[model samples]
Target: MLDQIPLEHILLLSAALFTIGILAVITKRHAVVVLMGIELIFNAANLNLVAFSRHDPVLMQGQMFSLFVILVAAAEAAVALAIVLRVYQHFKTANLNQIVTKEG
Candidate 1:
């Protein structure tokens, strides 16, 4: 089924998703939303990796790298959420601007 779709289309979709993720990360002030954006970015990369892997005949290196990327993303999310929780506990808010502007 995937073979029916052209590689260019897949790449375009991935690029669009990545761009949206970038916008969300840059524009959102909430930590959770930013984290979600980061996940979106990861997913976009995963899509590209999988799409490219379909064309390869000898080795599935792209799929392997995608798996590694997923593993790293999961670990990163766990650590980032822990840090966000600590920041919220210390600052009493998840707003990035407010947290930064407040005096320690």
Candidate 2:
């Protein structure tokens, strides 16, 4: 049943998600929302990797790469959140613009 869907459909969905994630990162002012957008972008890439891996059962490289990406994303999120927390503690706000202006 799952095999009935074409690969193009999955790729298209991944592209859409990636675009939305880009928009979120660009337009959102809050640190947490930007982090969420970054996560979305990572998931979009993961989706593409998994979808491609499904076509090739012999070499699971795509799946392996996706796992590595997930691990890296987790570490990135943790570090980014720690930084955001520290910034919030100092500035009392999560807005990136305010933080930047305050620094200058």
Candidate 3:
């Protein structure tokens, strides 16, 4: 017998993951934590895309799009991390709250 779990289950999981990411982005003061939160949100979106792709073999657009999203996320992370490193070197702090002053 085919597994009968409803599509709602996947959507629920995606919602939970998205909520966690939003919470992380809002509550964490560290720049890295915010970056991680952003990544989590992207991952959740990718999960949804893959789940949708599974039901249709002829049209794998969702899967292909997810792959592109993953690649973009990776590149974004690399560039963001490098920028964070530079900021830290100049400011000696990784806290997002501390870096917002115009003086710096």
Candidate 4:
């Protein structure tokens, strides 16, 4: 079944996901939305990794790398969200455009 689908199709799907993620990251002002976009980007890369590793049933290097990427992404999300929470607590807003630092 998987053999019937061409590699181009999988690549196209991943590319589309990556594009959407980029657009979200570029256009959205909300910190959570930015984080979601980052997650989407990570997922897109994971999809590409799985698609390319589908052929290598023996070694599965791409799959292993994808797992590592997932771990890294998870850690990034935890730390980033913590920072965002702190920023929100200080500013009382999650909007990136509205966040400003006060300097004396």
Worst 10 residues of 3 by lDDT: 1-10
Residue 18 local lDDT, model 4: 97
The whole-model C-alpha lDDT of candidate 3 against the native structure comes to 0.89
For candidate 2, the 10 contiguous residues with the lowest summed lDDT are 95-104
lDDT of each: 0.94, 0.93, 0.89, 0.94
Clashing pairs in 1: none
- Candidate 4 lDDT tens digits, 1-104: 65678999989999999999999999999999999999999999999998988888789899899999999999999999999999999999999999998899
Cα displacement (angstroms), candidate 2, residue 72, comes to 0.4
Task: Give per-residue CA lDDT, model 3, range 20-78, as digits (tens).
Answer: 99999999999899999999899899989977777885899888999999999999999
Cα RMSD for predicted model 3? 2.4
Best by TM-score: 4
Which residue pairs come into collision in candidate 3? Answer: none
TM-score of each: 0.91, 0.90, 0.88, 0.92
Cα distance off (Å), candidate 4, residue 65: 0.2
